[model samples]
Target: MKMYLISDNVDTKTGMRLAGVEGVVVHEMEEIRNALDEALKDRDIGIILITEKLGKLIADKIKDIKLNYHTPLIVEIPDRHGTGRTPDSITKYVREAIGLKI
Candidate 1:
């Protein structure tokens, strides 16, 4: 299984390329959808890494894919600009999920 990336910028794509990951850079919603479709169709691709900016553009679609599919896990990744999440996002998520303060 291989990993594929869908980045929003050339710099992020270039960096991933250096790490031996192949991907496309798309900014528009249609282009992001097409890239995701192509990646999902490939049996060899087991993981799909998409930039957080692009992920926010189609959060509902990403949620649906994650809920329905068993293959090609989709992950939201930070781009060259860094993560959009707050430093305590994970802690908040954990607290929310288990109803416990950590």
Candidate 2:
């Protein structure tokens, strides 16, 4: 399975590059839509790791993509300068999936 990283910040993009991500794309909002559209075409991409800030900015789009497509697990990871933890939206999904309250 392949992994992809997307971030708008240079530092975050650099960090993901240093981490040995085979494919990394740095994009602004307009570019992000096209990038995501192209990236989702890869059947081998099993994980899509996105920066928290960007994820929040495109939450609705992400949700729509998830509802439409079942592959390529979308994960919201904090940016390099960030705390590097799962965001609340992910946590909420996990909780709801397991029927837990927090």
Candidate 3:
């Protein structure tokens, strides 16, 4: 299985690069979408870590992709210069998983 790093900033890519993740791909919304589609076409990608900012911008598209594909596990992480987590994001997923508010 392979991992992918998707971000829109240079710092994020640099950090991932330093961490030995040479497959880091930096792109804007449309380009990111196209790149992700092409990457997902391959069967080796098991995890895709996306920056939260970009994820928010393309939430609908991500949701659609998730529903359609099962090989690549999509996870949202904070960008190098953004909040790592949000209360709303946490609560929403928690509520959906447990059927209760935390």
TM-score of each: 0.95, 0.73, 0.80
Ranking by TM-score: 1, 3, 2
Please provide, for model 1 over 31-100, each residue's C-alpha lDDT reduced to its tens digit, 9 standing for 90 to 100: 9999999998999999999999999999998999999999889999998788999999999999998998
Question: Over 4 Å off in model 3, which ranges?
Answer: 24-27
Better of 1 and 3 by lDDT: 1
Ordered list by lDDT, greatest first: 1, 3, 2
lDDT of 3 by residue, 1-102 (tens): 877778887788788888766455556677888767776886877888788887887899789878987779988778868775766987998899899988
| Ten-residue stretch with the least lDDT total in model 3 | 20-29
Model 1 off-target regions past 4 Å?
none
Q: Which of 2 and 3 is ahead in lDDT?
A: 3
Q: Relative to the unseen true structure, what is the C-alpha lDDT of residue 48 in candidate 2, on a scale of 0 to 100?
A: 86
* 78-98 per-residue lDDT for model 2 (tens digits): 765765455686578878899
Native-to-model Cα distance after best TM-score fit, residue 59 in candidate 2, in Å:
0.9
| Collision pairs in model 1 | none
Q: What is the lDDT, from 0 to 100, of the residue 15 in candidate 1?
A: 90
